[model samples]
Target: MPLLPALAVVLPLLLAAQTIEEQEWHLDALDVYSAQDQSRGDGVIVAVIDSGVDATHPDLAGRVLPGTGFGSSKGTDGTTDVDGHGTGMAGIIAANSRNGGALGIAPGAKILPIASADEKEQFALDVVAESIRWASDHGAKVINMSLGFSSSMTPSLVKAVNYAIEKDIVLVAATGNEGKEVSAPANIAGVIAVAGTNREGKPWKSSNVGTDTVLAAPAVSIVTTAPESVYSSGYAEMDGTSAASAIVSGVAALVRAKHPQMPAKDVVNALIKTAQDLADPGRDEATGFGMVNPMGALTAQFPPVARNPLLPEPKPSTTQPTPTLAAQQPVQPVVEMKDRLPFVAGVAGGTALMTGLLIALPAIRSRRREPVVSARDTPPTPW
Candidate 1:
């Protein structure tokens, strides 16, 4: 019975051979949304449906764009990341990565990468309603659906998310870890859903609770970047609710980085009135409206997103190759470090081997109470 594994992991370490140990609790809960007020959404644009995004990850190189891709039989304009789980939920929402690790939670947002995943129904209603009407004719104020669909609410996906909240945008779906039903565009009604929790807060036995969820974050076990695996090469850990809808679409790109004029239903009513309730106190069915602080929806008291900047930029990103010395030879740093010098030389050689086993433990308890000291003494003769 030594071979079991349908799946099971406590996560002490070796999450399939290691790499991500930096657990500062989901970047200190996204630094409570990057410490109250600082939305740098400059030239904003966030489509990120899911199943794409590592567009050559140099921290989402030049902020990813060339988007578009509706799974089965439709890819075009790159970034379909080929199931790296929407490029690890688009590097946890807007990966403005600084070289190594992968940070993002609105790290200066910008990503269109659509790609809704396979088995078309036009990849769930006409390519997610032509990518939410092409992200409101291309000025995407925010969409981020981390993917989910079990069918049922088909009215062309509730008028394409009510035409993306009348083009106010925002969207952000994914409440289906198959905890049963409600995924079709996240139970409609303007869409937000989001679910899945972990890091002790619980609720994620395949997520999805009742009454159209609407909150909760930190999707279980998680980790990330697993599409290009040479068997755990690029990175991989994934759990459910598609990484809590990319951590509330990176807290809706830090509440569109800072009320960039608040729409999308006033940033979904300031993330359900600055959620964080938890422990099933004011919106049960498993931790909804509780968790997903992002500094309490970017300093609560909202009001800004009414932009009509004459919408345009529906395209961008590329160039940055020139690394051929057999791809810049140097290599090595595949992330290991933390050997803390072999745990300080095995805790000083286990404290000098337990002080020489407690000074030989009274000569091993006086040689087991010194009795038979010689060879079988005279006992053998009697036998």
Candidate 2:
């Protein structure tokens, strides 16, 4: 069966048992309830780089920070969502359920919305790149890019991703929904590429799979906040790698909140190293390391520093040297180059003589040997 159809069949049944407050099954699946008791991603800013977020959404409320717009509607603040996609993503990361609204994975995290695209789903790489820089510059610790383009890595986008990495920003992006290879900037190095999993913990049929995919999250039939203008109820059920990326972003926020001084690479490593293996025993193309475990990621002991297995370990010094004899020696007077000219000339002459002898010896040996003329060479001369 097609993936969307199967999701449609499973969603209604799941929705039947869930009330408005309990609609966020992903949080329960990831065991976020327990993790939240420790840290709710307080003092961390997560940038949602997608179609603008609806700041007025009940669940979002004051959690949405002032955002900049990079879409066709220039200079407009990023509080408007024409497609409801960005709002859904933001709610997944930081929605407050205290008012009987949808619950977020990291309710205490602030959402910094950077609108870079529109309802047409058009993503300009330049705009996305600018938004990433803006987010990193604006104190965002975690940047979630739920939107993706079919094109492979773009130079500008890659530069922006690297810039974020340099700024100690943890970047999370959705592996595209084409069910083929993962897309950029998710496929870009250092970006946490997230894949979608259904409620059964199996890989979502439509979620793209590739070596780039680094994490999995509950994405199918996810209930999240939507824009009231677009989605009348301010809630909707959606399925895609986008939701998975947001969930992982929220988990990143939680990890960051716990370890405020953790570097971006180590923060990402904590999540992947502690993830629960799914499709395969270890890391696989379908599910990367495995489904993200928010509780495990939060409490898991991560190395204080990043370690790359591919890099050769530094060789330990085999011997300890005594104190430098030069330290105790008297300072020597500087010698003038003119005074050492004769010595330098002698060394240069010796080197030249040795080089000439080395070159002549081989030639002398060749001259001593008798040269044999080939029959073909003689015939060609005669011809």
Q: How accurate locally, in lDDT, is each candidate? A: 0.56, 0.71
Candidate 2 TM-score, true structure as reference: 0.76
TM-score, every prediction: 0.28, 0.76
RMSD of each: 24.8, 26.5
Which ten residues in a row are the worst by lDDT in model 2?
341-350
TM-score of candidate 1 versus the correct structure, residues matched by position: 0.28
Candidate 1 residue 280 Cα shift, in angstroms, is 44
Q: Identify the candidate with maximal TM-score.
A: 2
lDDT of 1 at 171: 78
Which one is best on lDDT?
Answer: 2
- Taking the tens digit of each residue's C-alpha lDDT, what string does model 2 give over 251-293? 9999899889888878888888889999658889989999999
